[model samples]
Target chain A: MILTVTPNAALDVTWTVDRLVPRASHRVDQVRERAGGKGINVSRVLASLGHATAVTGLAGGPTGRLIRADLRAAGLRDELVPVSGDSRRTLTVVSREDGDATVLNPAGPRIGPAEWDAFTAHYARLARGADVVVLSGSLPPGLGPGTYAELVRTAAAAGARTVVDTSGPPLLAALDARPDVVKPNAAELAAVTGHDDAHRAAAELRERGAGAVVASLGPDGLLAHTPDGVWRAVPPRPLSGNPTGAGDACVAALAAGLAAGAPWHRTLCEAVALSAAAVVAPVAGDVDASVHRRFRTTVTLVPLEEPDAPHVH
Target chain B: MILTVTPNAALDVTWTVDRLVPRASHRVDQVRERAGGKGINVSRVLASLGHATAVTGLAGGPTGRLIRADLRAAGLRDELVPVSGDSRRTLTVVSREDGDATVLNPAGPRIGPAEWDAFTAHYARLARGADVVVLSGSLPPGLGPGTYAELVRTAAAAGARTVVDTSGPPLLAALDARPDVVKPNAAELAAVTGHDDAHRAAAELRERGAGAVVASLGPDGLLAHTPDGVWRAVPPRPLSGNPTGAGDACVAALAAGLAAGAPWHRTLCEAVALSAAAVVAPVAGDVDASVHRRFRTTVTLVPLEEPDAPHVH
Candidate 1:
């Protein structure tokens, strides 16, 4: 079983307006809302692929109740811990005229120290029954930068492989815990490693302590630097659609591969295919199944020579 | 006691961003939410003025729960009827750079036939204990244009005077109910009567069936057409702040005057003063008490010789 954790879960609300005019009033006729966060999206993709997954995270107040209700409606296992503050919400306004989108993200609820302790204990208990634990998304207020590092250590102690998908200080801090795999999109990788080149950034992340590094280069595909070897997997073709959840789809495939102890080549291929399929899906946390199937076999994997420095210890 | 009915109650959410750039993502750090709607705002102002007030309307789902909670926190009476659909939310994004605001309003939840029946029954019961029943704001889906008319008739049968503040077809339909007072701002009055002149529009509204008409002309002040006489009440000077709830404040003062059987001159003076105070308040439903006190004795009241032909029955 794979356990996913989203510290700052959100009730994502999308509004469709005839046209978006800044500083003007809009009457929105269509609205769509769903439970969303990086880890939840990853778990949704994993569940769609027939993987056994349970989601555990911090949720509270009325918005939290709605999030839990949505998760239940989606048939996902809920092991969420409760807090006192209302959860955050993300509003995405899409323009019908030009297909433009404006996103407003509020900083999530502040987590009390006691709430963090309670969540840590809850995560440890859930980790005990999981073969793989995936920690994703931003840390809400009141949480330290080393939050993921502590969770990774808890998962390691519970004898589970941990996949960390976060950026900045959290990602950099999680490295010392030696997570089984770390997946950062190209921008995230550069932000943390200060290297614009995906190859150097992935190598730097691996040298810093990650057992494996997978950097997702949107449209360009996946770059992997693992103990087994270095390889780049490109999609069969560029797809045109929403790219919101493509990264989560990539993490889902990576977690699945890690759980099954698949080789780098096979894992990278699955990640590339699933990510491509997600782009063609209408909403986040969904994939075009036919596209996934077709692209799975056609994904081109090219092996690359190891970096000159060979920084791996 | 004054009872205000807001059929389409909302949880108004405000976010303050450094700047607003269309088609870009914004990280909002400050968020403020309150129970809001035209009727609710009226009730809030009335309550703040030491008037006995209660809010009765249709509210449901998670958003409704928040609305109820906020009303409770504000120390106002809550008589909201429940429905199955989630209540709507209005988002106002304010740019700190230029203080420009972008508003997004969603049509409120659709009320089922049974829910409307229940609300009608609930309102009738509340109206019986009230000296004034105020009907305000838009009608949600599943409600007809005659919704306010039906409520006005119900209030009359319960021996309660009604003050209606609404626009368009709803305003037109409510006129024949012979509400004690109908308040429409300059734009709303123009839209319903097709008269650009406020004096002509108010006279037309009174002629159509309103016992009295009070038209709020922003900055210019209040115009009242009533059985007693025609008068214009202007503030001592222009004050600037937020004008969002000024009309609601005007309605609150009108309802207070009706409940106390105050003469038209005194009522118009109070209405003009309160509206000006509301404009200077930082948020809707709030009044700068000092400003209200200062303006109350300073408002200029000019008697307009009846429009060539008197239209009052």
Candidate 2:
């Protein structure tokens, strides 16, 4: 089983309007809400792919209840811990006219110190029964930057491989715990390593103690720097749609591959295909199954020289 | 006691951002939420003025729970009827840079026939103990245009004077029930009566069966057409802030006047002052008490020839 953790899960609300005019009143034609966060999205993708995935995270208040209810309705395993503050929400206003989306994200609820301690203990217990533990998304307020590092260490101690998908300080800090894998998109990789090149950034993250580094380059596809080899996997073709949850789809495929002890080349291929498939779907946490199936066999994988290895002529 | 009914009550959520750029993501700096609707605003104003006001209407689901909780926290009486459908929310995105607000309003829950029947029975019981019943705002989906008319008749049967504050078909329909007062803002009056002139539009509403008509004209104050006389009340000077709840404040004062059997002149003066005070405040259902007091004695009232009376000059 794979366990995914989203520290700051959200109730994602999407409102469709005839047209979006800034600073003007709009009558929403439709409203769609669902439980959302990086780890939850990863878990959702895994579930859709017939993987045994369980979600555990911190949630609270009325919004938290709604998130939990949605999780139950979606038939995803829920092990979210309770907090006192209301969970946050992300409102995406989609214009039916131009298909433009305006997103409003609230900083999630402040998690108390006791709540963090409770979550760590809960995560440790859950990790023991999991082959891989995926720690994803932003840390809520009152949580330290080293939050994922602590969870990564906990998972390691529980004899589970840990996949950390985050950015900035959390991603950098998680490297110290030597997580099995750290998946950062091109932008996220550069933000942490200060390297615009995905190859250098992934190598830098690996040197910082990450067991493996997978950098998702949107549309361009996946760059992997693992102990086995360095590989770049490109999608069969550019799929144009919403790119919101494409990274989560990549993480889902990576975690699945790790759980099955697959080779880096096969893992990167699947990750690239799934990410492209997610982009083909309109909403996050969903994939076009046919797109996934078609791209899976056609994704091109190219072996590359390891950045840190000694020069060979 | 004044009872205000908001059939389509909302949990108004305000998100403040540094700047609003269309089709771009915004990180909300502040989030504020409160129970809101025309009738709820009226009740809130009355409560703030040390009047006994109870909120009664149809509310359901999570948003309704939040509204009820807020009402309880505000120490106002809550007699809201519950339905199965989720209550709607209105999101206002305020840009701090220019102080521009973008509002997104959802068409509220569809009330089942059984729910409407339940609410009417509930309202009838609540109206019996009220001196005045104020029905305000839009009717939820699945409710007819005669919703307010039915409520007005029910209030009358319970010996309660009714103030209907709405527009279009609902406003026209409520008039046939002979409500004690129907308050429409300039635009609302124009929409319903097809008269650009506030004076003529208000008089037309009275001619249609309303016992009285008070048309709020924003910075210009109010125009009252009642059995006693026709009068235009203007504030001392234009004071502007937020005009969102000014009409509700006007209705609040009107309901207070009717409950106390105050004369039309005094009622119109108070209504104008309170409405301006609401404009001075930043939020709806709130008033700057000092502004209200200052404007009360300063409002200028002018008597006009009754529109429907025979000319004797």
Candidate 3:
């Protein structure tokens, strides 16, 4: 079973309009709502791909209830610790005509120290049964920047491989805990690696003690830095449409490949294909099994040079 | 004493930022929240201008608590009857360079029938002791379009003069109850009167049986159809800047003048001057007394041709 943690979950509301003219009112033609958080998205995608995934984190209020319902709808097991503050709503004004998404996200509910403790205690018990633990998204208000690092340490101590998908302070802090895997987009990798180029950014993350770093480059596809080699898996074709859940889909595929005992090259290949399939798919973080099989056939993973055993230096 | 009803008041949040680019993140520089509702604004301005104003309506939940706190901070007297649902929040994204306000208002809390009964009881009691009553803004969920009409009838039956400031079906329904006054901006007035132009709109409202119809024309100033005469008052200068609360300011000045037993000219002049002053003021619904005095020098009130019996065909 896989365990995923999302500290700051949200009720994602999408309002689609033909055009968004600032300061002018437009009647929203379409609206879709889902319980969302990075880790939850990854877990749902994994579940859709036939992986047993359990989600644990803080959730409460009406929005929290909706999140749980979404988890159930996605067929993912969820355990939520009740919180006092209302869940945050993230509004996405999707301009379909222009293919733009304007996000208005509220600062999520403030989680107290006690709530964090409760989550950690629950996670510890759940982590004991987990094969791989994924900690994703930003730390909600009141949590220290090092909260993800602490969770990474906890999961590692429980003898489970930990994967962290986050950026900024949490990403920087999690580096010290040295998770087995970390996925940051090219931009996040650049910031973390303190490098301008994607290649150097990937190399820098590995040097900072990430067992492996996956830098997702849009259209250019996945660039994986493993001990064996740096494999750049470009997509079969340049994909179009929604790119919202592409990374989460990649994370799900990578986790699935690792659990299935596929080699690093094979895992990276599947991840690229899964992400591409996700982009063209109607629902985010989901890929048809048949489409997954078809695309897996076309994914080509080519390896690059790894510096040395001192890839760290 | 003037009683203003804000059945569904909100904490209006205005986020001032640069251009809103979809899918791209923005750094919000300033966030301003205030007690908001057309009636709340009118009562606040009335209080600031030294008029005795009392506000009554429903408020509940955490957001409702904040609304009440803001009202107190603004030094406005309000009797917010507690209810179960969370009070609404209206988000206005204002552009820094351009004078544009993009509003995203939540459909307000659902008020049970019991809450409605309680409100009417208190409103009637409040009406009996007030110089005039102003029923404004929309009714919350679970109430019909005629909710404002019902309140107007109740206030009028209690021998209180009332002004209905609303639009759409509610405005039409309130007209049936024949409130002493109805204040709708040009667009709302046009919808109610089936007359898109200001002159025709005012005439149409009066014909439908409104004792006095006050039409707010932004920048162009205020127009009125009263028992004494037909009048139009233009601002001293072309009004520029924020127009968010200009209409409410007009209504508040109208209500205040009526309370003072001011004649048609004085009331129209005050309304037009204060309405213009509101645009020049830093905030909405607030006309600086100094600015009011300055603008008062220029507002020209003209008497239009009055209809015999003031009844429409």
Computed on C-alphas against the true complex, the DockQ of each candidate is 0.78, 0.78, 0.30
lDDT of 3 by residue, A131-223 (tens): 888888877778888999999999989988888898988888898899888999988887776776776777777788788898888878888
Backbone clash numbers for all candidates listed? 0, 0, 1
In candidate 1, what are the lDDT values of residues A189-249, reduced to their tens digit? 9899897877888888999999999988889898999999998899988776666689899
**Candidate achieving the largest lDDT:** 1
Q: For candidate 2, what's the TM-score of chain A, rounded to 2 decimals?
A: 0.97
lDDT (0 to 1) per candidate: 0.92, 0.91, 0.80
Residue B155 local lDDT, model 1: 100
Clashing pairs in 2: none
TM-score (C-alpha, index-matched) for candidate 2: 0.96
What are the TM-scores, per candidate, against the unseen true structure?
0.95, 0.96, 0.81
Worst 10 residues of 1 chain A by lDDT: A304-313
Task: Give RMSD (Å) of candidate 1 vs. truth.
Answer: 2.9
Q: Relative to the unseen true structure, what is the C-alpha lDDT of residue B273 in candidate 2, on a scale of 0 to 100?
A: 90
